[model samples]
Target: MEHSDYDVVVVGAGLVGAGVAAALAGTALSIAIVERAPPPPESPAWDTRIYAISPASVRFLESVGVWQALDPARIQPVRRMDVSGDAGSRVVFSAYDAGVAALAHIVESGAIQRALWRRVGAQENAVLVCPARCASLERDGKRWRLGLEDGRSLSAGLVVGADGRDSWVRGHAGIGATLEPYGDSGVVANFATERGHDGTAFQWFRADGILAYLPLPGNNVSVVWSTPEAHARELTALDPDAFAARVAAAGNERLGRLTPLTPAAAFPLAVMEVEHLAVNGLALVGDAAHAVHPLAGQGVNLGFGDARVLAALVREREIFRAPGDPAVMRRYERARREDILAMRLVTHGLQRLFSLPGRLPAAVRNLGLNFTDEVGVLKNLLIRQALG
Candidate 1:
């Protein structure tokens, strides 16, 4: 078996994983990225899977050179956001009011992934190990070794687990995670709105669930309807026209009639929290470290936060300290705990509050929304945090 040595080994070449490798391009550390599949082929049709990229995340992508590679025509900037409570209460946020250019950018998942792949592939100090699977991971004195399925061995000072929710590295390292399934599925699709979105995003917290209309470039938008599993099944099973009409009515036809731009798809929802972000010779980023309810549209943003923080820490570490030094791991955990905990608690609490069937609960929640809306300082504070 061929053997290799590196300063960092990153597992899973998804957006966050690739971001980590790409972000460390000019660093002295030699990096290796392992993935089971090659980068996805480019597609002209819009991808149904999309994410709201926070301003802070945009800067991270830019630093890694992935942002510049993205096609400007495909990106959509969000100027305003309108959120409504089921009990007829509402809150509005504007980028102009916050003194920012835009709240966030609505981007397709594939575009970012492809861009990151291109950057990492060209990075001088990084090696892209595609179509590779991890067979075993074990400690070798001061370093960690990864055994690949294709009879190759990789030894590194640091192992980064950017794998998805069910992370093999996290499991092998004996890190525990608590998962709370919401018993709901997020149904997503794209549509051509009868009216333009005007760079505004809309969200409704309803008895059925939370529905969000995220604007795309031109007269198009993407919708994420988080509802019960049964309802999600029904939504995906609907004919294109029927699904579009139902979605239009749910959002009060605010964007007018809708025409299907893509077929609908759905995925189960859950909240995950890990016991530790780092151990002696290993660290977890993105979904591997934590996952939150998507209502706030911050899951991927949090993952990007993980990638950025981890990369910066590694790049700036003292010469005497290794990438997986105990002190470095502690710093990474300490830096991220507060942000991750706050987002998890907030999203989970909101989901439970809206899921309660009692009228009193609904009244109180909506009242709180309205009150927060009226408080300019409070609303701006929330927006500022979200902008990150």
Candidate 2:
């Protein structure tokens, strides 16, 4: 216990990485969070990147202390959500029906990352290391040796690669990934609406893309347009007024008018499913472990879910096993596989079914939504399950 090296080392300083570090901070383990780039000196006011945080995720963040620190005014509660198809089929969910104040919140991605980092900053057992590049990972008996570009080396009982989609640790661990583009780009931005959102989020399953407007902190809302790269760029290039008009029309004028809040940009859509999440003296968490269709808005949530389960396992373990025990890591991976796999199938299925203009599948899909709408108990259960 007199070692200067950490007991646990977490790579990546984003939401999931920070959450994992903070989650393990309560334990006896000494943890370190490594990031290739240092966090922004000044956390930006807003970011084009957005995330739909589910209720479960909100509770987890609250448990970790970030929720209390976030400005109340900056958190947008989604009282209602409207979902529909281009075929004129739709359904709406109200917080009253769910008996919850909000189904979820749409917050700037940067805000949550900062929140987690801030929470982790208070951890007496965790250290934040940045501008550190990982050159190689060597697993010796019962431990890991982390080589960095800074001409320094550190040893840990466990090394976690929460790094990201393009993870050096995953490569170092010999884990393989299957990545493929969805032939689309997700164009994301915020907007000023003529009318208040009333805490309602809207999503449309269009033939060419999926258009969603998530209620923001103010009267504003954020838009995510997943469509062909050309269309995405075209929308991003539109002037404020023209863009607002076009967005309104595309949304069927659901929220009245839309105005860009941030400079919009298009990111190529892709999905990465890793073969396995564990390696010798190493385990993967967050984007380093899996990637899902963004259309579901659970990318980071899935990563956090990984963090939650992994942290629980480590904290509750009876033996003094390294953080990266293959047996223990498998338990973590197994705990998450069902949830992550279900989400992957659901998101992928929705994207494929809605993106196609078919006769029977469209009817079936629409019918399914309406069916779920009518079945109150079933719908609630499904929502709860989906949020998890």
Candidate 3:
């Protein structure tokens, strides 16, 4: 097998891994990105999988030149968010009130991946290894050597696992993860609305589950309903028109009638926590490190945060310290623990609180929402943290 060396080898060229490569583009370090599949093909049709990119992530993408490459027409700014509880309680947050340009930008997952791929392709010190998989991994003193399925061996000072929930790299490194399945699936689809979204995002926590209407360009919105497995399967099995109508009614027809723009899909929901975010020569990013319930719409944002922080830490490390040094990796893990824990706690707690069958728990949760809505200082604080 041919052998190669790099300062860093990132597994999985998904959004977070590609973002990490992009973030480190101008640095002096050599980088390699290994992916099991080629970059997603460009398409005229909108992707059903969408993400709400936080302002902090926007800055990170902008720094790497990916944000500027995205088509402005395909991006939608979330100016306001209207959240309602099952007991007729509601809380509204406005970007203007938070003194930000927009709460977040709604972007297609494929668009971000494509843009990042383009940047990585042009990066001077980065190489993309498409259709490649890591068959095995071994420690080479302070570095890690990866044996690819294609008969290539690559050694790197650091190995990064951005390979999603079932990370092959994480498993190879012997990192243990605890997974708490939500026993539900997140159903996603896109639709054209009769009335304009006006840059407003809506979310409802009902007895059935949590439903979110994320605005898109023009009279369109992307829907993500986190519901039980049976309900999710039933929703995906519906005819296009019936599915759209069901979704429209679920949101109280807030956006008027709906027409399906993409076929519905469902992914099982779970919260995952790794025993450690980093080891001597390996580090985990994105879903490889942690995964939280998506009810807060912070899953991708957190992944981006991981990329941003890990890249920064590596770049700013002491010159005497190697990238894979245990001390250096520990710092990255330590810096991320609080943020990951906080998100998991919030999302999981909300899910449990709302899932209770009794009327008292429902009333208490709704009352809390109403109380938070009226508290300006508290709401701003929450928005500020989310903006990060």
Q: Show the colliding residue pairs in model 2.
A: none
Could you tell me the lDDT of residue 342 within candidate 1?
91
Candidate 1 stretches greater than 4 Å from native: none
Report the C-alpha lDDT of model 2 over 1-388, residue by residue, as the tens digit: 2224888888888888888898886777888888887555435456677788888888888888888877777788888878897777878888788888888887777777877887788899998888788877887788888878777777898888998889888988889999888989998778888888899889888877998998887778889889988888888788777877887899988778777777777888888888887766678888888878788788988988888888888887625746666677879778888888888898898898887777887888788778878888878886776566
Q: How far is candidate 3 from the true structure (C-alpha RMSD, Å)?
A: 1.1
lDDT of 1: 0.92
* Per-prediction TM-score to the true structure, in the order listed: 0.98, 0.94, 0.98
> Per-model C-alpha lDDT, please?
0.92, 0.82, 0.92
Of candidates 3 and 1, the better by lDDT: 1
Q: Please identify model 2 stretches exceeding 4 Å from their true place.
A: 1-4, 41-45, 318-321
lDDT of 1 by residue, 265-324 (tens): 998999998999999879999999998888899988999999998988888873654898
* lDDT sort, best first: 1, 3, 2
